[model samples]
Target: MSTTIEYVRFESTDPTELAAHRDGLVSLLRERYGADFLGAHLARSEDGSFLDFLLWTSPEAAARAAREMPGDPGAAGFFGLIGEVHDMRHAEVLHSTQV
Candidate 1:
């Protein structure tokens, strides 16, 4: 199966707090999703908005996380810090290279 990438663009007033919460969220995902959760990256744009990239083993895994994450108690703190979600999307990984 091809990998899937989940992208989320959002704003957060307290980036520091959001970063801290992100650690816990990542840990929770790793524990829950195991190998299906490939990894994630959080980036801050020049305009101050944030972008999150989550890599999953398949589209099904990404969709399942999207459906369940909001209701997961461990994710509450992470979600609470988001001021607004500008966009969210998922796409199949066409190509990837790692050294």
Candidate 2:
């Protein structure tokens, strides 16, 4: 199966609040997605925007997880902290190189 990557970009004014929300989301990812959740990473831009990268086993798995995220009780606060979603998309990894 090919790996699917979830690329999300959002803007936040409060870094502290964003950190807390990121932690909560990570916890939820582990608790809810478990093995299906390959990995996650959070990054910030010079303009203060945030980017979240999530990897899953497949596109279907990623889609399912996203569809159910808003329904997760723990996600309420996290979602609230995300002030604005600049962009969100999923794509298949066609190639990769490891050293």
Candidate 3:
């Protein structure tokens, strides 16, 4: 199955607090999704917004997480820190490489 890249772009009032939740969020995803949850990355833009990327084994897995994560009690703290979500979407990875 092809991998899916889920990206969420948002603005947060407190980047530090939002960053602090990274490990917890990742742990929760790993616990819930296991190997299907490949990895995650968080980046800050020059405009002060943030971009979050989550890699999943498939689109189904990505969609499942999107459907379930919001209702997950463990994600509340991380979700609460986001002031606004500009965009969220998933794209199929055509190619990837490690060097």
Candidate 4:
């Protein structure tokens, strides 16, 4: 099965706040979505922008989670930490290498 990937970008001037947001979102994803939420990779740019590569089992599953997240009480604390999503896109993984 092809995995769905979400490419996202957000900007934050405060590194500490950004880290906290990232952690909270990751924890929420894991706790709420479980195995359907594959995981995420985060990176910091020189200008303090953040890029998040979120992996999911499928596009449909990802969409459902996204749709419900806003109404989930557990997700409330994570909502504000996301900052401004400068860009967001979904893709099917073509290839990958893991150690």
lDDT of candidate 2 over 1-99, digit per residue (tens): 779999989987777877778778888888888888888888998888999899998998899988999678888877777778999999998986769
lDDT of 3 by residue, 1-99 (tens): 889999999999988888898889999999999999999999999999999999999999999999999778899888889888999999999999989
Error of 3 at 92 (Å): 0.4
The ten-residue window of minimal lDDT in model 4 covers 74-83
Better of 2 and 3 by lDDT: 3
What C-alpha lDDT do the candidate models reach, one value each?
Answer: 0.96, 0.86, 0.94, 0.78
Worst 10-residue lDDT window, candidate 2: 11-20
Clashing pairs in 1: none
Error of 4 at 34 (Å): 1.6
What are the models' TM-scores? 0.97, 0.88, 0.96, 0.79
Q: What does candidate 3 score on TM?
A: 0.96
The Cα error of candidate 2 at residue 84, in Å, is 1.6
Higher-lDDT candidate of 1 and 3: 1
Best by TM-score: 1
Q: Over all chains combined, what TM-score does candidate 1 have?
A: 0.97
Q: Give the CA lDDT, 0 to 100, for residue 35 in model 4.
A: 90
Model 1: worst 10 consecutive residues (lDDT sum): 79-88
Off by over 4 Å in 3: none
What digit string (tens of lDDT, one per residue) describes model 1 on residues 1-99?
A: 879999999999999999999999999999999999999999999999999999999999999999999789999999989888999999999999999
